[model samples]
Target: MKKTSILNKLRSSGLRPTKQRVEIAKLLFNRDKTFHFTVESLGKHLAKKTTTKFALATIYNTVHAFKKAGHLSEVHLRGKNNTTYFDTNISNHHHFYDSETSELIDINDNEIKFDKIPKAPNGKTIKNLEVIINLKN
Candidate 1:
């Protein structure tokens, strides 16, 4: 999407069109699929850029705001510090995490289906179900 279009999207989503937010959104939504990123990695990536320089705190704030506005989702990976990854797909699906490379791969929804949901002992309904199939080299 063009910068103007992205800015319009942010505004339509009730987010203030800050330069940092727009830059981050462009990165997150530029690709055809979702991606996993760490704050440190993102900072380092942004640091090398001249046009878009975002502070670590600003990245966190923008990410949180986008998440709150339903523009992104946070993935919780085991043995990792609450690493926040954005999902532009915004559809129900699973993920395949390559442990060695720490890559997040999307599994198509049609490729898998559950005939029946397993019962939860505590009478808790499943709000969302995600399968993170860990792969080893």
Candidate 2:
């Protein structure tokens, strides 16, 4: 998407088109599609760019706010550090994690479908279904 269009989309989503937000949005909105990035990773990537400099806390706050605003989805990767990854694609789907390289790949929703959902015990309701397939090699 063009820069102007992206800025317009952000404004339409009720997000303030701040300098930091725009820079971060460009990184999140990739050319092909979805993107997976951690706060630290994103900060590091942004730091490399001389023009844009954002604090880690700012990144965290912006990301959380964006997620809450329904612009992004957060995924937690189970491991030693319990790292969190943000997904640009907001659609319902699964992920494939390469444990060896720690790479995250998106799995289309159509590839797998649940015909019947099991009964939820107690009063808990199923809000979202997350499937993380860990790949080992």
TM-score: which candidate is best? Answer: 2
Instruction: Compose the digit string of candidate 1's lDDT tens values, residues 12-119.
Output: 667788777777888777676566676676677666663776877898887777677777777666634446565565678788888677677888878788898888
Error of 1 at 127 (Å): 0.6
Please give the distance, in angstroms, between residue 10's alpha carbon in candidate 2 and its true position after superposition: 3.4
- lDDT of model 2 at position 100: 80
Off by over 4 Å in 1: 79-82
Query: Could you say which candidate leads in lDDT?
Result: 2
lDDT of 2 by residue, 1-137 (tens): 78986786577667788888888877776457788888888898777763877988879988887788687888766743578888888899899998787789999988878888888779998887888888888
Each prediction's whole-model lDDT (CA): 0.73, 0.81
TM-score of each: 0.82, 0.85
What TM-score should be assigned to candidate 1? 0.82
Question: Which stretches in model 2 have alpha-carbon errors above 4 Å?
Answer: 12-14
Q: CA lDDT of 134 in candidate 2?
A: 88
